[model samples]
Target chain A: MKKHIAVVSGDGIGPDIVREALKVLFAVGAKFGHTFTTSSYLAGGAALDAVGIPLPEETLDGCRNSDSVLLGAVGGPKWDTLASNLRPEKALLGLRGGLGLFCNLRPAILYKQLSDACPLKAEIIGEGLDLMVVRELTGGIYFGERGRTDDAAFDTMAYTVGEIERIVRKAFEIAQKRSKRLCSVDKANILNTSQLWREVVKRVQGDYPDVEVSHLYVDNAAMQLVRNPRQFDVIVTENMFGDILSDEASQITGSIGMLPSASLREDSYGMYEPIHGSAPDIAGKDLANPIATILSVAMMLRYSFGLQAEADCIESAVSKVLDNGYRTADIHTPGMKKIGTNDMGSLIAQSL
Target chain B: MKKHIAVVSGDGIGPDIVREALKVLFAVGAKFGHTFTTSSYLAGGAALDAVGIPLPEETLDGCRNSDSVLLGAVGGPKWDTLASNLRPEKALLGLRGGLGLFCNLRPAILYKQLSDACPLKAEIIGEGLDLMVVRELTGGIYFGERGRTDDAAFDTMAYTVGEIERIVRKAFEIAQKRSKRLCSVDKANILNTSQLWREVVKRVQGDYPDVEVSHLYVDNAAMQLVRNPRQFDVIVTENMFGDILSDEASQITGSIGMLPSASLREDSYGMYEPIHGSAPDIAGKDLANPIATILSVAMMLRYSFGLQAEADCIESAVSKVLDNGYRTADIHTPGMKKIGTNDMGSLIAQSL
Candidate 1:
């Protein structure tokens, strides 16, 4: 097997963590008889410093040519003074839009090793929490037409049937691969957009009869996540709801540093990244955790390259390290052995 | 002092719980030497069953004439088959709109007596959770202009400067009375409506210097609610965000039966109710919890009548009862004495 990934180690702790994740990727490639090649691309503050732009033309082109894009993170206080459009964070918006990635897959997995950190009680969480929030990223309120008048300001949440259909189909396909349970969350009782969203979901659901489908109003869905997270497997919703819910799902797991996300298109091409932000304060320090970025590589393998066994191997290796009482500074407890960024990456790679 | 209340004991357990709450209200009046008068009005399924209408003209007129309104609960399976506009739940929307109830106050209070019921770990909750969500009920997405085309469906989220000012003022006034901490939740970075909302929140803060003010993106706010709920006091947001957050806050408290809400307009006049729904299955039986309704009475006294002593007395009495291990079936534990709705209300009234 041969794979080429566009690597954008954006800024701050991005370079450091992405380095460790790539080491693990190389380890997976060697063990599984696969050739994984990566091309470095400038984005975020790094590109802002190098070429005076947040996202260079070369960067987007490189990602478009590659099988998948692996990103670390994008923003910091250093670029806070820059104009909104010229800021480091704009790289993310540009990439997602330019690449035509319509849906975002964010899996919230509560590791048993880090279960003590979870906000939820033991009984509520039961065994462990593992759920994916399939967010329709390209459209919804965030991308809607908005304007402000003298007395009033307005934002329009408009959704075409085509937009809803694609995301619903993607969610159903993803559910078919996982636990086969799909919960479509919307405020159909109120919003016209959600009504259309619900209609499209129901229309697309007929094709995937094997998948168990259900509907929850956004309010009830938020309550259910806090009350009983174990009841969910795959939660699909529009952009804004997904943004709120996915973040909530991550918080309940109690470890934001360990989560990875993939922004996918209709095809297999996707952009993989750690959901956490770039910590400029700990930029050059070895204090940053690399597990999220490493797990992102696993997502790229599983979702983008269709390398299930290889992905499983990488995931298990990371889990095994945690099970063996290894810890990064952020996720470290008193009893666990704390290791630096490089050491943790080496340990995971050697284990793989 | 004399107060007139419009009592709309709508349907199902509505009558049973309202009866108990009225008993406690009478007790409060008896102890304080105040004249309290309640006019029983028909609404919801009860109104529909009697006159084939969810909310009658007489009911609306009675409520408008009263100092305050106390509602039990509304809607059941009996009215589920009714036309959308004629359904029992339409009474709520009608009441909120008809009364010009622009702002909704939902208090999410975690009782130490039922701390075990809370879904969060003990460490996260700290002392206990007590926060109010001041939601702009009459504006934003719920009341926004919405329409559907053949290919696309659209809903407009529009906010006037006056609308944001009113809600922000209400929330600040609420915070002034409480711990004096206000958190305005919005996605100002993206939506134009939210940008105006944030500006109004900022402008309103100038009038209240004693209160500590802050802002949070809705996604981060959702995460923070699950992560550390103790950090907030009064969270004010637009209607849609409020609907989602207040429900999440209530679920985290783990006893939905104990929560109460208040909807208010420009004047001191308000409509109060339990946040829970009509438990039709327990209509004839003495199985409903009366505390939420009783609490709603306390809110009416505090907000509408400005009878702080009466409110405090009612709250303390309820707490004393719960502290003494009295519980309704909904909140009953193994060792706690589970009493019927009538007995629980009688006990709280006796304590006062």
Candidate 2:
């Protein structure tokens, strides 16, 4: 097997953590009899420094030509004063729009070893937490028509049947592969877009009858996430609601440093990254956590390269590393063996 | 002072709980040197059974004519199969629209005695949770124009300067009387309406110089609620965001049956009720908790009638009753004296 990957070590502590991720990826390739090639491209603040643009055309083209993209965190306080469109964060928008990545998969999994970090009580977080937030990335009010006047302002929340169908189909497929349960979140009682969302989800469910499906209003869904998170498997929602819920779900795990996300197009092409932000204050320090980025490579293997066994092997190595009492600075408990980012990544690679 | 109250004990446990609340109200009136009058109206499934409509013309008129309104819970499975417009819950919409109650106040207060009921870890719920959610009810996406075509659907989220100003002023006034810290949540970076909201809130801040103000995106706000709820004193947001956040806040408290809410208009007219739903299964049994409805009366005394001392008396009495080991079925613990709904209400009334 062979794969070519585009890598973006954007800014701040990004380069430090991303370096460790590639080491783990190389270890996976060596263990599994596969060829893995990578191309480094500048983006975000790194690109702004070199070319005065957050996202260069060459970088976008490199990502487009690759099978998948692996990204470190982007943006820092240094670029915070830049104009909105020219800021380092805009590079994310440019890449998503240019690559046509519309479906966002945020996995909020709380490993039992780190359950002590979760904000929820032990009773409510029974048997550990594993839920996927399937967020519609390209549609809804974020991309809707908006305008402001002297006295008023408005934003449109619009959805086409095609938009709803694609995401719903993706969610159902993922649910079928996992626990075979999907909960579609919407505000159908108030919004027209929500009604259309429900209709399309129902239409898509017919094609995947084995998956149990349910519906909840966005308000109720938010409450349920805090009350009994164990009930959910895959939760699909619109752009803004998803934006709110996925963050809430991530926070409750109390280990945002351990979570990774994948944004995909209709095809297998996708971009994987850690959900945590770049810590500029710790840039170039060996203290930043690298487990999230390493796990992101695992997601890339499963979702983009159709390498489930390799992905599972990477995940197992991560769990085994934790079991043997290895810890990065962010997730370190007093009893655990604390190690630097480089050592943490090297240990996982050795286990692989 | 004399006041006339319109009482709507709508469905299921509605009648049972409202009776206990009224008993508490009369006790307050007897001790506070005030005169009170009351009129009962049918407005929910009960109204549907009698007058063939969930909200009859007379009930709306009666509530409009009164100085203020006190309502019990509404809706049940019996009314669940009805058409959307004819459902028992529509009566709530009718009352709010008819009375012009545009500001919804949801208070998530977890009593220290009931801290065990909270879903968050004991360390996270330090000092107990008491935060107010001031939600804009009549504007934003819920009241905006919506339409659906065969292939697409859309809903407009619109806000006017006047609308935002009124809600901001009300929130500011409420904050002035409470902790004086206000957290305004919006998605200004994306939506035009949110941009206007921030602008209007900034303009309104000139009149509220004594109140410390801060802003957060809705997603971050949701995460903060679970991570550190005690940090918030008062939170104001758009209708949809409010709807989602208030519910989430209520659930984290884990004593939903003990929370109360209020809906107010510009003038001093308002409607007060419990945040919990009508538990049809526990309707006629003495198991329902009346603390929320009784607390609603306390809110009415303070907000609608400007009787702060009287409101404080009611609140203190309710707390004192719990201190004396009286517990309703919903909030009962092993060593506490468990009592029926009527007995719990009587104990609070006697304490007042």
Each model's TM-score? 0.98, 0.98
lDDT of 2 by residue, A228-302 (tens): 999999999999999999999999999999999999999999999999998999888899999999999999999
- Single out the weakest 10-residue window by summed lDDT for candidate 1 chain B: B187-196
Model 1 ranges off by over 4 Å: none
How much DockQ does model 1 earn? Answer: 0.89
Off by over 4 Å in 2: none
Each predicted complex: what DockQ?
0.89, 0.91
Q: Each model's RMSD to truth, in Å?
A: 1.2, 1.4
Report the number of the highest-DockQ candidate.
2
- TM-scores of chain A across candidates: 0.98, 0.99
> Which window of 10 residues has the lowest lDDT sum in candidate 1 chain A?
A80-89
